[model samples]
Target: MSVENVMTLEKKKGFTLIELMIVLAIIAILAVVLIPKSQIFKNNSKNAGVTTNVNTVRGYLETKVTNNGGADSYLNAATLKTAIASNFSLDSSTFVPTGSSSSEQLVNPFDKTKASVAVADKSSGATNNTVDTVETSASDGADGEVVIYVCKDGYVVFGVDKGGDLTQTFKVK
Candidate 1:
C-alpha cells in the first residue's frame, strides 16, 4: 500500500484513549449504583430467613401444645423450647439460632449452643415481668430446665441464656 493510504488507515482503525476512558467511567458508575443495592437485598434475605425460621418453630410449638389440649399449652419460652426439642427433634446445634446469649437460640434461629432455655410464667404465683417457672413438652422438672416468663399481655417470652435476655415472645394459639 502507499504511505498516504497506510497512514489514513491507521488513524481510522484505532480507538482514542478518551473513548476507552469513557467506557471505563460508565462501568464505574454502574458498579457504584448497583453494588450497594445488591448487598442490601442480600442482607434483607438473610434477615427474612431468620424471622421465618423463628416463626416456624413458634408455630410448631403451638401445634404440639394444642394437640395435648390447651391445659398442656407451652404458655412460655421454656415449654416451647422443650416442645421443639421433643416433638421436632430439635437439637442444640440447630437450635442455637443466633448469638452467645441463651435467648439467642430462640430469637436468632441460627445459634447452635446448649445454653439454658427459659420461659415467662403465666401462673398466678409468678411476680410481674419476672420468670418464676419452668415448662416443657417433657415431664416437669426434667433436667432440660427452661426459665419461664409470662408476659403482662398474655404472651410467653422464652430465652436461651442465664440472664433471660433475647427472649422470643409468643401468643397462645
Candidate 2:
C-alpha cells in the first residue's frame, strides 16, 4: 500500500477518545435505565420468594397442629422448633430463618437488607422480629407504615401490607 494510505489506515484502526466516550455514554445511559429496572425486578422476585416461604411455613404449621390432637391450639416458637426438629426434617436446614431477632437471624434467602428477617420494604423494627410477644417488623410503627410480620396468635398466619393495611387471605383459623 502507499505510505499515505497506510498512515490513514493505521490512524483509523483504533477508536478515538471522543468515539470511545460516546459509546461509553450510550452504555452508561442504558445502564442507568436498566439498572433501576433490574433492581425492581430483583426486589419483586425476592418479595415473591419471601411470600411463598411465609405461606409454606404457615401451611406446615396448620397441618402439624391439625395432625396433633389440638383443635385450636398452636405452637409457640419453642414448640415449633421442637416439632420441626422431631417430626419434620428440612433438607436444607440452612433455609430456615433462625433468629427471632436481628442478632439471631439466619440467612434469609430474599432479605436484601442483609438481615436474616425479610421485610416488604425498608424501615426499622421489621427485621424478622417479635415485639410484645407479637412478631413485628423492626420499624412497624415508626413511619406510620405498619410493617407486617409473620407473627403468632400463638398460631402463625400469612399476610402482607396492602396500602398500609395488614391483609391476609388464609382461612385456617
lDDT (10s digit) by residue, model 1, range 91-142: 5433333433343233432233432333434554544432223342222111
Q: CA lDDT of 93 in candidate 2?
A: 30
Q: For this target, which candidate reaches the highest TM-score against the unseen true structure? A: 1
Q: Candidate 2: where are CA atoms >4 Å away?
A: 73-156, 160-168
How many steric overlaps does candidate 2 have? 10
lDDT of 1: 0.45
Instruction: State in Å the error of residue 16, model 2.
Output: 1.9
State the displacement of the C-alpha of residue 32, model 1, in Å, after optimal TM-score superposition: 2.1
**Candidate RMSDs in order:** 9.2, 9.6
Q: Alpha carbon lDDT of residue 20, candidate 1? A: 94
User: Measured by TM-score, how close is model 1 to the native structure?
Assistant: 0.51
Q: Write the per-residue lDDT of candidate 2 for residues 1-173, one digit (tens) a residue.
A: 79999898878778789999999999999999998899778756655554554465556656765787552365544445445433323212322434243432223344323322222221124443332344433334221111223333324344333222333434333
Question: Candidate 1, which segments miss by more than 4 Å at Cα?
Answer: 1-7, 71-79, 86-90, 97-170
